[model samples]
Target: MKISMTVNGKPVSAEVEARTLLVTFIRENLRLTGTHVGCDTSQCGACTIHLNGRAVKSCNILAMQAEGADIVTIEGLAKADGTLHPMQEAFREHHGLQCGFCTPGMVMSAVDLVKNHPNPSEETIRAELDGNLCRCTGYHNIVKAVKAASAKM
Candidate 1:
């Protein structure tokens, strides 16, 4: 199958197998390994990415489903000049990640949440992020990072 999409800000086109997962296409075909695949069953949000500005678990979607969509991964969150996004800076400042496996998804989800609710309360942040699991930070710092990012936004 031939897939065409805008990834990270660059237009990309590739012929892929019908069975190829979106995560596999991103990491293998496009060489964007920042989107991790912790669980292929979609239980883990490690493979999250932005599809048309909304966060989705790439592991659950086939590459063909993403054809012609606008996709954004962790690698695309930074400014073209290399400066980190406010969320990325907040995560770093607040120590939101430990093992770093869940950071990409967490950041992606955080970006979406903040976009919708720029001043989200702690409880709202927690409830919104219930789907994305972080085994390392105990979620305390992750919440702080979201709050911090929200303030910046």
Candidate 2:
């Protein structure tokens, strides 16, 4: 199947198998390896990405399903000048990640969370993050980072 989509602010097209997951298309086809596939079963949100301005688990959808959709991987979250997104900076400033494996999806999810809730409380942040799992940091700093980023965002 030939899939065409806007990725990381660039229009791209590639030939992919029907069974190819969106995560594979992003990581293997597009070479945007920042979107991790921590759990192929979709239990983990490591493959989360923005699908048309909304966050979705890339691993849960087929590459063809994303046809012509606007996609944004973690690599595209920053500005062209190389400035980190406010959420990324908050993750760094608050030490939100430890192993870094789940940081990308976590950051993406947080960005969506804040978009829906500009002033999310700690409990709201925790609840909204139910889909994303992080083995490290115990979510203490992660929650803090989300709150911090919400203020800046």
Scored by TM-score, the top model is 2
**Predicted structure 2: lDDT:** 0.93
State the lDDT of candidate 1 residue by residue for 17-80, as single tens digits: 9999999999999999999998788887889899999999999999999989999999999999
User: Per-residue alpha-carbon lDDT of model 2 for 1-153, expressed as tens digits?
Assistant: 888999988999988899999999998887889999887887879999999999999999999999999999999999999999999999999999999999999999999999999999999999999889997745999999999999999
Model 2 steric clash pairs: none
Every model: Cα RMSD to truth: 0.9, 0.8
Count of clashes in candidate 2? 0
Q: Which ten residues in a row have the lowest lDDT in candidate 1?
A: 129-138
lDDT of each: 0.93, 0.93
Best model per lDDT: 2
Clashes of 1: 0
